[model samples]
Target: MTCDYDVVIIGGGIIGSSLAAHLASEKNEKFKIAVINSTGLGMPASEAAAGLLTPFQLNELENPVRKDFCFKSFEYFPEFFETITSGSSAKHIDLGYRQAGSLYLIFSNSEFSQKENETRNLKTIEPRLSFLSKVEIPKYEPLITRDVIGAYHYPSEAYINNPKFLKAIYLYCIENKVEFLNTTVKKLNISSNIVENIVLDNGQVISAGKFVFCNGVWANNFLKEIFNTDKNIIKAIRGEIICVKALHAMPLRKIIFCSNGYMLPRPATNAFETDSVLIGSTSDEVDLDKIQPPLSNTVSGISSLINLFKTLVPDYKDYLVSGCWAGLRPQTKDNLPVIGKIPEIENLYCSLGHYRNGILTGPFSGKILKDLILENSTEYNIEPFQINRLFETQIRGIPKYASI
Candidate 1:
């Protein structure tokens, strides 16, 4: 059926932005596109992301789908970042781009054994990661506290200023021309297993040739109605972080992670001569609106960081507290993201259900989604994330709802 646009993407989070940006760049003068989101999709989760871009694979044995996607996305950032900044106006300088490296600090033997095996297997597929001995830790981060232990350092791991990156994508996409629909999508109108129209909370109805339900935790609700879920595909996972500005100018050389928490240093500002540090975070599952940090909880979420920092970097105690906040991550039961078309919906597709590692997997997701929509062969396989798995999860006793 003819429609106003070639594609109408739901959810304006990072995945939606990246996809729109990529389509704008690739489509050039071709297909028209639009991005839609909920009343508050830009709040919390996407805005508060730690924005870590490490390439280290996790829980491969338990969820190879995310492991595969993480590696695929990590490999795309270098060129992806290039594509993003290619035609930006000369007035703006590149913001907080860190190609320095990242350390997955290890203390316990269990973490060591698990990471070591994953690193070894990853080495065969990607020669990008290497294990760092305890002695090497001090050399990489000279300011590292004396209590530091052995860590796995990914030298090519890069990072960006979260706010700046978000703004850049918005600007670049607009320049290249991607329509953003800022309204709450009430429901999806479907018939014969195809998305026909989107009914927005604002009383507007829009139709398109294809629909991508990349609505993070909200995906399960609609997927349950559209396609029954069986396995734990997408769950709303909560996390928190604290930002501290140090009295002394001692900032971290690389992103610091311990079994307890992590400390990421922001680029220096006049207000922050040395720089600000992001020490976070705690992982839990809860609804966003129901979850607000009580004053008592402020000191609670940070307790882990305080203890871990003392062990990873003794000097952590010397820093002054700047600010603190909380965020939610769309965690999947299998800890992987769903890509490609939905089995039940003929022309409907999704790229959501990415858990904690969404930041690490954002880039490759865009390319794959665009390629899939156009029916092009992708560099990596996406069969592991099919929405059909959600049907299995529903059979196993998971609650289902409609698009929120």
Candidate 2:
């Protein structure tokens, strides 16, 4: 049987698009790749991401494997950004990558002490981590309110313009001849254990040698349909962000964080036309069945973000609200990403569920997927992210859908 393409990746977000770009970059064997998406590229999470590259969450991650994964992805970012931008003539596009570091504000002596201990523990892996005293906080950010007693600074942390980064990867994929199909997948043609073809909502059928599910929160729908189970392997966590411009002059030079939320310098876009910053976010888990638009910012969510910004930078309370938006992050029961081949299904795989770390880990995740498809060994530990780790013997029979 002849296949229309070598691989068909489902999802246009960073994870899937990065995988498409990686496959397109292969010199030994050029894979004919097609990316299918219901919405436009990076509509939900990818474009809406605040683009923080700090591994400070390392202190919060209990799993050793996850800690290493986060750190490795953090270390791999510089090269990944360069690789995506090298040949593209899109110099006009500001990818907004900067290594200016991040500061987590501490409000009281007790909070400072707690954060000091936290930074000390994190210093083993992140040596650059340090605590700044109340007097020293002004050295990095003078605009921080006096309520901030101190802060923990990660000097090597970076930030990027997520939408621009996604666009760059998408352009790279197009330059490498990757086809993008703009439609929703209706179902999979599963027969005897392999996904031979994908049926679209428009009644179109496309054949492929292999199928990869990367559709983020919506992956739960496909999983339920294929496994004929009510278990939601991947769930949606909604986060909202608001963009504001500094009416007078730029008030921040580095990313600032507090207990409420975070404010980071956003590269001035055509909409702002001046120095601006992104203040966000609120993480609230919503029932998948209830979200009509799937992604949208609530008035309360926007108000909370504005309050967070005001608390962080009380001196600059006169900022202009440019835009507000929301996105759904794909989370798993265990909170680790689902990458690698699916159990019992030949020529089928998944690269989903990176959750909050999708942007930070996306390019490397793509590398992992490319290596898996090509049967090449990867240096990073991927055993913890396998399908059987979650599904086990439950993946026994063919999908409930009709087969070709």
- How does each model score on TM-score? 0.86, 0.93
Cα lDDT, all candidates: 0.70, 0.81
RMSD to truth, every model: 4.1, 2.7
Tens-digit per-residue lDDT, 1-404, candidate 1: 67877888888777877888888888864688888876554353566777777656254565655665677787787777777777554126555778867788777688888778777876776576777788887888876765535888777777766656766777777787788877778888887666788888878888888888777776766765654433335777767777777777567889876656677777664343457777777876775445444312246677776665566666766788776666667876566678887665667888886666666666679888988887645767777776555555435322232232
Residue 133, candidate 1: how far off, in angstroms?
Answer: 5.2
RMSD (Cα, Å) of model 1: 4.1
Candidate 2: segments with Cα more than 4 A from true spot: 28-30, 40-42, 269-272, 391-404
lDDT of 2: 0.81
